[model samples]
Target: IFFVSIKLTVPLAYFYILLILVRELCEKFPGSLYIPIQTYLPYLASVVSTMQKSSTFVEVWAIIEALFYICLRLHIQWLQYKDPLEASLSSAPMLELWERRQLWERIMEIETDDPVSFVTGWFFDQDLQHITRYDVLDFVAWSMFEGRNQEHLTGDELGQLHDFVDELEWKISEHLNRSDSLIPEKNTDKNEVGDNRKDNQETPITSEFTQEKNDLDLSDGISSPRRDQGDRPRNQFRFPENVDDDSPDFFTNLYENYHNWYEQTKDRLENSDFHPVQGIRNYMAEKRQQIVEKEKNAMATASNLAENAYNRLVSPGSNMDKQLMALSHATQSQLMDAWNSMVEMKERLETAKFVSSKRKVLQQQLRGYRHLLDSARAMSSAIPSNQMADLMRKITQCNEAIERVEWSARDAFVKATGYARKNILQRTEPQRYAKYSHDPLLGISTYPLMFHLLILGVTDGGLRVILRRRGFERRTMGPIAYYFHPGSSDHTEDENEELNDEDREMTPIVFCHGIGIGLLFYLPLIDEMLRLGRPIFLPEIPYVTGFRPWQSP
Candidate 1:
């Protein structure tokens, strides 16, 4: 009977979806559509359907209603796919629990499934990857999807990603406008190109290296030119010496291999239109620029110290010069060592595709590429003069769309992407970190950045690392806060507990959140803490979100 009536039921199902959509619209904006008071026909239809007996008129109208819904749905689906940018994602499907958990976990850096979600298998495909929405999608569907989300972005999550990308582009553009500080002799415009071209020319690195060779040669010609090794500072900061002569760190070795991998994938670019490779390349360019700035900052700090030492060295105003002179020598010698080490370190960094080979990483990265990369590469492939203009328009459109996102939308966006999570459980393979548990993922310098701020941590990814380091299992936390808290200390079954505590502790941490989080904001956090064997008590903050005005007094 079910198979025989497939056509009948399928049309009804389609109609039901549209009916809900229309009902939502009507309820949301009753006056905007200016429908007559009789616009309540759908409700009457629903009520009549519930009646014990229906008239012939009702039966006839039901079939008509189903057809009308089918047409509306077809029109909507057609419109969605007509936009090339939108069409790619049309087949991406809805989020699945596992994929959504993974994506949300990867982004937020934590594992909590407060509100379970599912990411469609289509969207998960690396072969048919969509980068645009992946790159910028943090929008909560009902903030559009949920009743909550503050709707802090451009009306939704999609808008938030656009806004974030625009801000970053503007910053990148600004950086390019300024003079390149890395190679002081050449302007930034030439310097970046020069650095990249080194592989092509097979030239020896650095004009500085050439100059140093000349100075060495000249000094040798004069004879008796051996500088004092005694002058070298050993006790203080020392750069890694003999890097080429010595073994490389794991990061360096891995990156070197990755570069070779990139070369291997060069053909893939030609075959697949080279869009994804181009996205990775753009990301690498941005990262490379950042690396340059970091190097410059390090050098400038060393040079400033050197200058200060020179002032103290000849002055000899007091006994302090002894320490100051030592300090200066240490700083200068360390600087030289650093330059040498970096030259060695440079050998390890390869422009290789990493996240590419890994499926999970690929999906996440592809999401970042989708819409923007398609436009960018298309623009880049275009001929020069007109290319710049087209690129500018695309960029401007992206920027305008981003700037339009409101704070409420931002809040909603974060909620959608798992940024606004409080407590929950996520099933993931155990993360391997540290030689031993309890080693913090963040160094003290980096840790404070994740602390209380006007904004939230971009995602729970970092928080998750912290949780895993603390020795709590995410999904394995048993029924009780301590499944066996009062058990004997020697129980091998209880590896999660920190047996070393003085036993007077209540919890490892306590957080005070802005109000109106409505217990939901903490679902993720609560799950994380419990997994880590830590209990958290969340108190309310005054003059904050979600609190009543009368409660403030």
Candidate 2:
């Protein structure tokens, strides 16, 4: 009873498992896979059941199972066609049928005597078994379109291959006929349906769907050929014949029209003037240069004042009075120069702002031409006529030339208007003056003032601090380096004790900044050094200073 129950339960379990597999497969795969699995699954089950019986037919069932498995494996691998989106096909069903044909041709290359031998031989080929079905079809396409070498194949192999090809073709045709009812047609007759019939009666249809050619309008002969016409052979080019007068050939006419268009474009670019905004910018730049020069002189005087004061402290009876007096006189002169430069820069900056309207119009025109040129270049590849190649080359040359002139004018206007300078001011200044403001002065719409210099004073670390007000009391000008001394304030005793014997000796760091950079940006670095209990000095830069005098242009 136990053995009889076991036999019955095993067969029942196998049936249940097979049914579950079919259900899952139906849900997971499209018809591409579902069709074959649905057709062969019942046969597979019967063979398995036959092999379980201890009869003489069990060995025969096993042989049949091996052959079915091999055929099924080969069929599954080759039937997995590429997507419709990839192939750019209107119908996926048509693509599946086409892939079926491709697989049939590939299977025909075997030289074996029987179908089982052929299947085994064909399946074991190193080059053909792996990779995608689409790739296999592509290889076949290359051999068909280009020449293929079949010298290695024997005469008997060729005969077998052709015979297999005939049989496979017949089988594929039969499968396609079977699947025909399942695959939807590319065009469905809407008039045969319910609401679609009423809609079709009221609305016009496309030429492809129209039944009556006599009632159709013939206003336009035909729409332009497909955009891929350029990919066809050179012999496919078609142009309407001109038989009236002795006009030039199609290509000659194209060349002449393009040449005239190019000349006109170049002429328009050449005719345009250098806008007046450039002059205003140049004037502003000149004034700014003067201010920068004056600031340099002032920096020199400040440095000299510090040096003179330091000399006096170091040497008691030195002839430092005369040197101090000369430095003071130079400092006053430099300050006056800076003041004059600032006033002139302000006036020129205002003048440069007036030509904003003219600049806008010029920019619009330049952009339009650039966009037109780009459109022309984009259309070049889609143009079917090979004769247009020469014309396109000429058009490209003309476009480049116009671009060069337009860009040069643009650059000049930018430089004259001090656009880059204003951008720098926006980034470096505080958020309060970050908005558009007409004012062009320190801590406002321009480079900020170095307030650190005003609060700076001498320390016990032998630093020579130059007071700007005191330096102006005399007249001379020079450069100055402000020094910071660690262990000079209330924390000095504790800092000194904390320092190791090796770190007790301090190496002074001279803080040098580049052009257009200010001391405020380096405050973080200064703070870090102070935390490390090390001494640092900052030198004043001239060109970056907020004040200056106007120079003679």
Candidate 3:
């Protein structure tokens, strides 16, 4: 997600620079470039260009044509940086803008195969270094040529917008399609449906419906995909507790038969310190945590610097140059802070490098830890597995989040997608994050849409569309991380203490109420659904305000 956004921003930022130049130019010219249509038309009429004896009216017509050409060119170029609203647009601008908007929207909707991380493409063979930034640059250059002295967006910003959108989309989709991917597909039931319309294609599902595209129709009515239904194929999707072959357990058991392989793969070294699956996880987790904390601290510090810069910029009577200078200064400060942190961490690690002579002892300890984690990561519940009905219920809850962002911030969202940022204001507000009573059953509701959005790493139009229908604005917005409290080997969480009935089926529970209404208002009901049995991670929430003032780029 980060790389994608960076890739996108480079061009947008460049274009923004161009826009800044245009704005400065127009400000200098005043009536010459930015006059009203009335004033504009009269000026055009004053120019004389006719070869056939220049009469006042003839000369006026010639001047008007010249000015009209100029204005038309400007309008076309300005529209080139089309907004995300293109998908919903009823009309389009001239060639440059229209084509560019279409291209961007297509990029925005690009979907990747799941289980592949959003960062995957960016990292493949260090794809970032090899990535040509030209796709965005070309479109941007075209937009700036004749259009409004500026585009609705600068190219760099538009690129960043694309990355931002992509990342959010990836995170949201990931959250929805969790290993326990049941939510989004439940209502959109054609998942199992094969394309019956495709000739010679074997349809795996059994019922009236056919193909994934049949989603909208099936929810309205119960239309099974497979018509030639005999004995329904038993679910290939193996449950962990009630283990199925397709389940990880299926391979795990096979891998276990090769017990030594599970303990120590040949690739790691015959007597490598790296223990099998479990030990690596622990090592990775600890290492990852260290990285995360450093990152968080850096971001916090950078944010502080940005806030200070913004404060200075917005002081009344500050000139445009002052604001630009502040933006430059703030950006530099943040970058320097991040670089210093990274360097410090790198040096410390380098200096305290592990002693190789102790490798043998470390290997032994690693083996032990690895085995423990392998057992831990895979431990299924000893208790009876959750009922199918319960799982289905949670799936339904997650489905709701898939469409919530569409209508609420309709314009803001659409505009943001195309780089229409006016200034930074939070989408949600800062307040104490309200802690909710933990209902293991409410795991579905608490799964955290904002987290999911951030995790999947992008927001599409869906959330806003749903939000508008509900008529709620983003009262308070901010990032939130809901901790999923640890459970036993299986994925279940504890029931809310107040609501006794120990035997009552409880799924893994996560609590999220914090800072603003973004998480509090939108998430609760959804989290209630996704809880499974034990082996849960305890819930922890960390967030910053929805927005903080930063120098505008």
The best candidate in terms of lDDT: 2
In model 3, the worst 10-residue window by lDDT is 238-247
Q: What is the alpha-carbon lDDT for the whole of candidate 2?
A: 0.39
Candidate 1 TM-score, true structure as reference: 0.16
Q: Which ten residues in a row have the lowest lDDT in candidate 2?
A: 429-438
lDDT preference between candidates 1 and 3, better one: 1
33-134 in candidate 2: lDDT tens per residue? 556654777675444444344354633443444454445444434333322122221212112223534554454433212332332233343321232222
C-alpha lDDT score of every prediction, in listed order:
0.37, 0.39, 0.35
Backbone steric clashes in candidate 1, count: 50
Off by over 4 Å in 2: 1-53, 82-216, 222-292, 300-553
Instruction: Evaluate model 3: give its TM-score.
Output: 0.15
TM-score of every model? 0.16, 0.15, 0.15
lDDT of 1 by residue, 244-306 (tens): 221112332344365666566666776876655357557767987998999898777797887
